[model samples]
Target: MASEAAAQMNFQTMEHPAPMPIDQRTQVLLTPGFGTQFTDHMVSIEWSDTRGWHNGVIGPRHPIQLDPAAAVLHYAQEIFEGLKAYRHPDGTAALFRPEANAKRFNDSARRMAMPELPEEMFLEAIRLLVEKDNGWIPEEEGSSLYLRPFMFASEAFLGVRPAKRYKFLVIASPAGNYFKSGAPAVSIWVSSDYTRAAPGGTGAAKCGGNYAASLVPQAEAIERGHDQVVFLDAAERKWIEELGGMNLFFVFDDGRVLTPALTGTILPGITRNSLITLLREEGLTVEEGRYSLEQWREDATTGKLVETFACGTAAVVTAVGRVSGHDGEFTIGTGGPGQLTQKMKDRLTGIQRGLVADSHGWVKKLG
Candidate 1:
């Protein structure tokens, strides 16, 4: 059954008068670097206390008009989600676990004290945008149409309470490789000074503020010549939490794997969950519990930890070849993509591209 929000709203399409030329679009698609290139159209839905969700639109991408004193600008009430629309082998597009992304978006909305968008409406919004801009879906390997769905408080007010009005939008970007360096494996810098989230905080939420707080440390990592930053627990400042925007997984030499438990401080990642399911199906024991930075260093030094990788919607599965912090630096395995890491990436990407059977029913084909 369709939710009230979905049933009450109908997306009105507004075609672009002067869309990008086909040759230019094709050139951009050939080398769409990350989020640099956008599609012709986007999806939007407005919400208010009185109107609920109405005025859904699929129109040309344009700048938004937000009041200077909007609630989002003042109180930082914003949430967003990231997923991909992959072009399958047979010239069809499919989304991987979009329902999961919708659920997580609502979870972030709840944590941020915003209105929950109905799952039906959320999925429909993405579908409308993806279908409208299907040409923007990249055909090359390691490229796809990256979808960003976000909601922000739009009510113009200067108060601490939740806003009465909101705007939800979905945008598409033709993305190639996430890491521009083209390194076989990424190097991570440990953030000793700053922590991402603590217990009873918004660490688990996919809000803009959480990411806003991480920019400084992320910049520091870049300055130190690393690809990404990893944060520890805010309370103890020892237990490994996650990266700036990804989840961590440690593979052991004894055919066991471990990831930091979801203790209300780590974002429950869809890719992380999918990888766990895949690992378990391969008859490997995957544990989720507290893993300290000290333990990571010790295990890598003693060869107990053979591989470490980060997972997220954008990067998928990237091996952590090297780790560095204020204390020192250490290499994981051979300081390159591990055998299992490559295997996992191949299997996951294979399923995503429809080359392998999606036994888990995760692929939602949109023809």
Candidate 2:
């Protein structure tokens, strides 16, 4: 385990405050609903044109000081990544596909006109923080230590150019499942009003601006009594895209699974990728291609679309109950988790928790 993890991410421990003992009750809150809280410690590193990346620190959680004129504020030069620390039954803690997060972080940085963090440094930051605050790891079912790593232009510049100074930091949240309210099916509002990205934009990169852009549309969906917003293609606004934060998947009654082709406008969620892999392993046929809104609605009405879901680090695999668009509303597959969706979720979670054999060797044990 160590060797495989080392090949992808190297670690350097940073000392921090002594961990506080977590009571059984508190631990119960940690897992049941995962990411609404945080751990006690955080990891950070600084970067500049002259000094480069240095002054690594893993310490008690605290607010960071930022200049009012920082480049991140003026130009919106920022990027972020998310993953989790899962507590195994053996009292050990591990991360699922952390190296993938590190790689995505670099991709975001490049797109945001910021400097990239080394793969080793990114991995080490999460490892040290999770280990230091090992007590904060929730022991509840589905609970995890949500690790957020982000970088932004920290230089106090006024011009509209990329700043050479930046800071990278990782904060951990003790997360419950994203839908603390319940695991009930969620409704999505189809948004043909706004475009998430253009062809040459930061659509695929896990950056802050994309999320910032999603806030307004998401608010509209909520106002309309929907749980989330789904976007269509930018140019045509006819093809199905993805949710504001998660990737979309469709299942057919005949057992064919399909997700949008990576057209550079959709975020390649780690969970989405994992599901494709796990399903294929179970002898399921998976398709990655464009599925238009008209085609989807027609299929659902004709009983072809059996299940629809959104995938992300926070939600894992959430069943999509209904899709409401400006034209009309289409309820999908009795608006519940389908047999295939549930089975895929179980298999993916099994691999994450060490409950099943990891054929792909995705788990990276931290201890």
Candidate 3:
């Protein structure tokens, strides 16, 4: 016999009702880092070609069961996204431009030969999860609940084609700040031997493969006393691409800001896009063009490169103190976070944490 709600929906809840105490939660909220600790509950939903998306559930945060021959395991069919859930001054929980992440998540899904999840469903999952764990949202300054929404192929198949089954999950972690010390002028190492992306590759998408390719070169840069590594174009190796995890920005001496144009290679970061808007609002001329390392070194040495920095979802806006290469190196504008970099970081984080007015409607309230 079919039940009355069978025509409507199916639901699931946690069998183990384990939640952290207020003291424990306070301890985590006070600590600061990304991907460090998880909340009490997480949201999970299933999808398959045969049945589409279904089986939504909110349960205790725990490890996922995967088959030995899962498609994601064998073929590496996986993608993920990162954003934050902020606790506002009025005692409300909110998210910053979650819909944008939904669109980007689908963008990654299409590029990775995976099924596209509906944008509403993606946002709904975030809303559901954050609402359930509202207590986990941190109230400290520069702190938030870092929301990580990920999807992967769950089919236990040996084939090379796209998997028929998929799993989408959202987990929240309380993160204080991405930069341990603070956002200051940092150093960048120019990588000549390795490039981040190639033509007609997974460069534009936020996939694990691109990050994996950057680790070795990034290690080289870190060993050489640098905080980050910047890549040149794959073909000519002249035009700037981006950093290992952030996007580059250059401030000309003439009061003009320039970032590398999106030429189907660089990742269109959310923070990058936001900065473009924030700078223009402050009555600054920002340009998107191909910036060369040779010119960067020359300009920085000659004081034409007044300011240099990076922007990303993780760190927001960070100042670039210097750019160093094998042959030569140059310090960017007195080797500290420039005036513009500091102001921009302040404005962006201000809007995110509700310290300033959100005229752009980028924040989505959760509770």
What is the C-alpha lDDT profile of model 1 across 166-224, one tens digit per residue? 99999999999999998999999999999898899998899988999999999999999
- The most accurate candidate by TM-score is 1
lDDT ranking from best candidate downward: 1, 3, 2
Q: List, residue by residue over 290-364, the lDDT tens digit for candidate 3.
A: 988888888988998899889988777899997888878889999998899899999999999889899999988
Clashes (candidate 2): 9
Candidates' C-alpha lDDT: 0.94, 0.84, 0.86
Sliding window of 10 residues with minimal summed lDDT for model 3: 1-10
Which TM-score value belongs to model 3?
0.95
TM-score of 2: 0.93
Count clashing residue pairs per candidate: 0, 9, 0
Residue by residue across 174-223, what tens digits does model 2's lDDT show?
A: 77778755756899898888978778899999888899999999999999
Model 2 has an lDDT value of 0.84
TM-score of every model versus the real structure = 0.99, 0.93, 0.95
The regions of model 1 sitting more than 4 angstroms off are none
